[model samples]
Target: MILLDLFHYWVFIAILMMGFYTVIAKQNLIKKLLGLSLFQSAVFLLFIGIAKVDGGTTPILHPSISTEIFSNPLPQVLILTAIVVGISTSALGLAIVVRIKEAYGSIEEDQIQSKDESA
Candidate 1:
């Protein structure tokens, strides 16, 4: 049962692995940034999944209900912050890539390295 439950996470795992492989194996700076975005998305999915509860409700109190299970709000708050950070990181990375392209005339890592060596 436990192992079967873990199967639900296979897609996220696959996406994470693909992102890592893309970042590592690709020579294009734009592709690497795309992979980084994918990686961040996968992390977001995991955090949201972990924050879910089987029968949880929002953190609220009801006068009629004596027993209530409320989900933790901390993880959600943290994930929101992470999302903002991720956006900022991606924006900065893309700006850098643009500058590199302008300077090197190509976004490929090997090309950039060769240009640097020749200069």
Candidate 2:
């Protein structure tokens, strides 16, 4: 059981690292935005996945329902906020990428700056 738990933790960390590295290392503006978005989604997945209590339910409550199957709702609420923020970030990032592409005829940061410097 302990080993299994450790393995799951390692998996999450690995996913996180992969996403982070992509976000940091990508050259294209759109690729970087995609990496950032994936990283955020992985974080939200970790949030929701880890928040599941043992033997928990889907957080719905009804009088007809039953003897205590309540799962945590806080994580769900927080993830909702995260999703909204992610959407806004994606929109902003797309806007920025469009502007950068327009300004330099390319999205690579170095190329864009070089174009600016040359002109």
Candidate 3:
């Protein structure tokens, strides 16, 4: 019963772990970047989840609405900034991977390492 109340947190943990595992286990540079994006998405989910409040409304000042509980807008604002940053970062990472592929002739980590060692 208690676990059901915190389902979002569980989902966040699962996604975070999956992303981390992919980052650690995948040998392809593209896969690693995808994993990083997933990791970033999980973090975004966490922040959004934390910002939610039960019986809370948007932080707007109205004359009639007597509700005192209000969800924090700061986290949502920060998450928006983070989302833009994350997209920029992913684009940069993909650009780097493309360059790596062109230079190394392969995107796999092991192959790149072996080639580097031989050269």
Give the runs in model 3 whose Cα sits over 4 Å from its true position.
63-66
Query: TM-score of model 3 relative to the true fold?
Result: 0.91
For all predicted structures, in order, the TM-scores are 0.87, 0.87, 0.91
Candidate models: Cα lDDT each:
0.87, 0.83, 0.94
Q: Which candidate is the best by TM-score?
A: 3
lDDT of 2 by residue, 1-119 (tens): 89787665667677777878888998888888888888888788777777788887777777776758577889878999999999999999999899877767899978988887888
TM-score of 1: 0.87
Count backbone clashes in candidate 3. 0
Instruction: In model 2, state the lDDT of residue 52.
Output: 80
- Measured by lDDT, the strongest candidate is 3
**Which residue pairs come into collision in candidate 1?**
none
The lDDT ranking, best first, is: 3, 1, 2
lDDT of 3 at 118: 100
Off by over 4 Å in 2: 6-8
69-98 per-residue lDDT for model 3 (tens digits): 999889999999999999999999999999
